[model samples]
Target: MSATVAAILVLAVGTYAFRLVGPVLHGRVELPARLQELLAAGAVVLLVALLATGALTEGGAFAGWARPVGVLVGGVLAWRRAPFLVVVLGAAATTAGLRAVGVA
Candidate 1:
């Protein structure tokens, strides 16, 4: 099949599988502790992977300063346990201010 057709089939199958999982798992069986830990770690791993990849890209292979600046500010904000909205706004403002002044 063509790539587009294959993609549609995969998406449809995956969506149906997940939608089925909810009803199939409706208090039928409790998640094992090990499985729970693995699931939690999987989420964290995916988040870190995305950040290390190009979630905040400027359309290049790490060719922008906004990402690093935002990461630093966000890291600091998290380290200090600041509010989520404030941390996000601070990161955006830092990236915007830096780019506006031609730092990137």
Candidate 2:
């Protein structure tokens, strides 16, 4: 196999092994309450960081005002419990409409 393929296979196996360990040790290991809380907060922070990065940047540069505005609209709709399709299409439409009017 090529080096790239071999590396991919190794990574796949490692990922599966790590996932398997979680279930195998789930009830056996006990985590402190503080550690669990920290993990939960860390997950939220990581998600927010990812969302901000994706919404505001492209190729390591600013993505422009249109994209972030679109994300804001989508977030508001989602928070209001709008349908999933509506949230996605609304964001897309908002971005496209802004770009169409030369806002970006």
Candidate 3:
């Protein structure tokens, strides 16, 4: 197999193994309350960073204002407890409308 394919297979196996290890060791491992809180906070920070990067960037550069505006709209809808489909469609429509109006 090509090196790229082999690397992907290895990563896939490693990911599954790590996932399996979590459940298998769940009750066997003990974490302090502070550590648990830190882990939770870390996960939230990680997700926020990922979202910001994806929403605000393209090819390592700013993605223009329209995408960020669309993300903001979707975020507001989600905060208002809109349905998942509605949030997604609203974001898409907002982005499309902005682009159509030459906002990007």
Better of 1 and 3 by TM-score: 3
Once superposed on the true structure, which residue ranges of model 2 sit more than 4 Å away at CA?
1-12
Descending-TM-score candidate ranking: 2, 3, 1
Candidate 1 residue lDDT tens string, 53-87: 75456566665876688778977998899999989
Model 1 CA deviation exceeding 4 Å by range = 1-14
Tens-digit per-residue lDDT, 13-99, candidate 3: 999999999899989999999999999999999999999999999999999889999999999999999999999999999999999
Candidate 3 residue-wise lDDT at 61: 97
Candidate 1, 6: how far from true, in Å? 11
The number of the candidate with the highest lDDT is: 2
**Least well predicted 10-residue stretch by lDDT in candidate 1:** 54-63
lDDT scores of the candidates, listed in order: 0.85, 0.99, 0.97
Error of 1 at 79 (Å): 3.8
Better of 2 and 3 by lDDT: 2
Q: Model 2, range 25-54, lDDT digits (tens) per residue?
A: 999999999999999999999999999999
Please give the distance, in angstroms, between residue 10's alpha carbon in candidate 2 and its true position after superposition.
4.7
Clashes of each: 0, 0, 0
lDDT of 3 at 97: 96
